[model samples]
Target chain A: MENNNNIPIDDLTEEFVVNIGPQHPSTHGVLRLQATLDGETIKDLLPVLGYIHRGIEKMTESLGYKQSIYLTSRMDYLSAHINNQACSLAIEKGMQIEVPERAKAIRIIMAELQRLTSHELWWGSCAMDLGAVTPFFLAFRDRERILDIFEGNTGNRLTMNYITPGGVMFDVLPNFASSIKELLVKVKEHLKEYEELITGNVIFQHRLKGVGILPRELAISMGCTGPVARASGISCDVRKYHPYDGYDKLDFKEIVIDGCDSWARYKVRMEEMKQSIHIIEQLIHNIPEGEFRAKVKGVIKLPVGEYYQRVETARGELGVYIVSDGGNKPYRMKFRAASFSNLGALKPITVGAKIGDLMASMATIDLVIPDIDR
Target chain B: MKSLFQYLKEVFLGFYSLWTGLKLTLYYFTHPRKEIITEQYPENRTTTINIPERFAGEVILPHDENNKHKCTACTLCEMACPNGSIKIISVQEESEDGKKKRVLDKWIYNLGMCTFCGQCIDACPQDAIIMKNSFELSVYNRNDLVKTLNKPGSKLKEKE
Candidate 1:
């Protein structure tokens, strides 16, 4: 109490710091953020990740191409399909394998569905972060249908390693088309309801509008992608920029909002879900009938070279960099997570924002901590 | 004084957003009878999965009434397991014709180490291993988890 600002006399200008999590609900999952506060405003913030790091990259080097798909599912549990897609694509590209057209369409449908599912959950969870509990339950309600479809096809709900290297692990069931089509309509209707519920809500806007603003320049410098970068008016969507798995042929808009705030991020994802549904709808009737898997060599051995592949997961750009040395296993595997780049932008945006605003800002970043840690 | 109106508009806008959220919750609460999506899991235990099933669970080798298990002691499951969860000890015994026929001495499956990846089932060449839907795998003791599939003298008198 030596100074009027209640700063210690020795450290008069310096701020007090509080560790936000390794367990806090605000963190989403085991993310520790050390925030230095000057009064109510965040002066400086440092995000401490790797508490949940299980050496997934090191584990991948030991596992074969097929075995590594299961490990990829765990890295970003929310968007396992995307993780699996990236890994499978890397192996497919490395091995120069040709996946069937029917398989490509199926993979696109599943990937788009996963994007919608991930965004829906993100929207609901982000709302919950701002103390709106209703959207969380509503989002899960829609997510249940997606999980049902996943269980119908892949036998697992969240960790769907359905898509494999040569093609998908299995073909879409006969009823899968009708069920997914029905889900598209339901998701669309629910999305409109969600618009009324959260998007147009007054409190949501107040909490989000012009808060946690990341300018286009800063976002580019940090290499932020997905909704975070999109919110800041940067067109960095991997699906649009570099199309994979028939995404090039599909008709969909890249949802971008120049608001550069939490609201923009929310808006981007909400619109992206609609676009995902649009892509899913176009692929429904035209699901070509052909062999699901192509002729992959009995044992996969990548020649000595490096291969890189990226896919737009719900969080952001998921880049898989693989180094092979004429072996069955990858010599080295590196994952450039979307969340890692998004989280890097956090300190710049959080500083000068209130502590309450910090939570809103972090939520807008849409981090999957496992993706960051992995 | 003009800024006051703009400030008030923003304030009203914020309140309207919150009200919209509340209205949604109200709709769900009122529409409670609209197909309760949550399955009462433990109570309603007979939840059948959709077809083309990919349920990753425990591996069980089918046994007939005479207790003849399908395993031929090939040890392919042992080779397939990434964690070395499955172990097979082959017992060679002299048949009626004096030929040394291979039989499972002890089929050791450590549930603790198993990932339930169904890799063992995929590796079994004899169609011996099949993944059962019995997912209730929790046990009190770690020792109880090490399940042995084949015991001695449990083989059928005549092969099918």
Candidate 2:
């Protein structure tokens, strides 16, 4: 058979290529990975993207300031509230409108609650990716309670678009604090169950412990943020660093771990979930007795200039940049989505790891693809 | 001997961890009624449906029993909609006082393109449109989603 084959046998190497998902369960969204493998070891990994790009930034150019805020929620849907808040804060900065104290408190509370929900889903899905399915169910069970709180307070669940230019769309419901307190009670009790289900599992730990090690310099060069960067000894939590929406007054810890592995990323999020609960507890009791929304005038027009605002979403720092030419619609809008930058660090860390370990590393990075594509 | 001891330690810890997780699973399997959270959606729709009151399912123009709406055909909602999901068709008619008044002929909402962002409800100056709580909005045909919200012969409500 070797003699009968075509010429130039030396030209062909032992390595072959495998494509993992434009539609992969390993990827949280539509992210495709082209991996050159020698046996199970990935030699080169390239991420093929733009499967779900809707050109949200270009579309926002035609829409008014109020209408543009709604489009940001579509970018990173897991942290949709934070995305909306980033856009709203940018608009408020450009217009020079002071958001009311009550609105600021309400914004922080919703952002924290959403952070908890996003991390819970990440915890569940990360476990599910590693072959333990029960944790996903448990995770969803915890997440539904927070989503219910969101639905009752905001008109919608995912794309509420409740954060407007100067303030929030509606005031908190009477039961907002009571229901959150009840949710906190349940979440604290179930965290132990989460510990039992997935955190302590021997197989899960072995799979994640030393896989996909990203160094601190590499993480900084790649511009990685949120839990991914925090795992690698980067203290880049935007809430702690920049302190938007009165995060300065709140008591919480920024979680940073030096493991520089998938396990560290997972641990950072788990600790941050506790911190989120702490922030909510601080604000839930003392929502200021004032207007939930500042009076934003009709047809919001920013002075002809450039405006930029950054907020730490559950995934990472989301920077909203708007260029207005003294008009209702922005002349140009750009969303520096966190996932887009984090996805770049994947290939650098996963190049020599086995294919099975790729899932653990990728899951820990926690990409929501629309954010990347946008 | 050291290799054997390390091997035994790993095996023992693995089984212990799996067993602890399995115990919770066994407890759940024994008492599913207390622990079960999922609903079998389509089959038990009548029995277990619990949509929240503030859910923004679809945009609707609410009318009173007298068949009167509050729309003045101002077209603010049309302008406010990010994707042109709401279309207001207006016609200028000579009123009883001989003034040319633009009246609402049709308020069309395309649910297929809607993000359910509630911008229309927020932009409505007359409070004519409200997002209803009925969320089972799927249909067999896409064309069926384009609904005319204003009823035939519905007139504008007089100012209080």
Most accurate candidate by lDDT:
2
Residue A67 local lDDT, model 2: 93
B83-120: candidate 2 lDDT, tens digit per residue: 88888999999988899999999999999999888888
The local lDDT score (0 to 100) that residue A224 gets in candidate 2 is: 98
True contacts kept of each: 0.61, 0.80
Q: Please report, as a residue range, the 10-residue window in candidate 2 chain A with the lowest summed lDDT.
A: A4-13
Enumerate the candidates' DockQ scores in order: 0.52, 0.76
Q: Write the per-residue lDDT of candidate 1 for residues A226-303, one digit (tens) a residue.
A: 889999998888888899988989888988888999888888888888888889899998899989988665457888
Chain A TM-scores, candidates in order:
0.95, 0.96
Candidate 2: which stretches are off by over 4 Å?
A1-13
Q: How many backbone clashes does candidate 1 have?
A: 7
lDDT of 2 by residue, A275-302 (tens): 9999999988878998888887768999
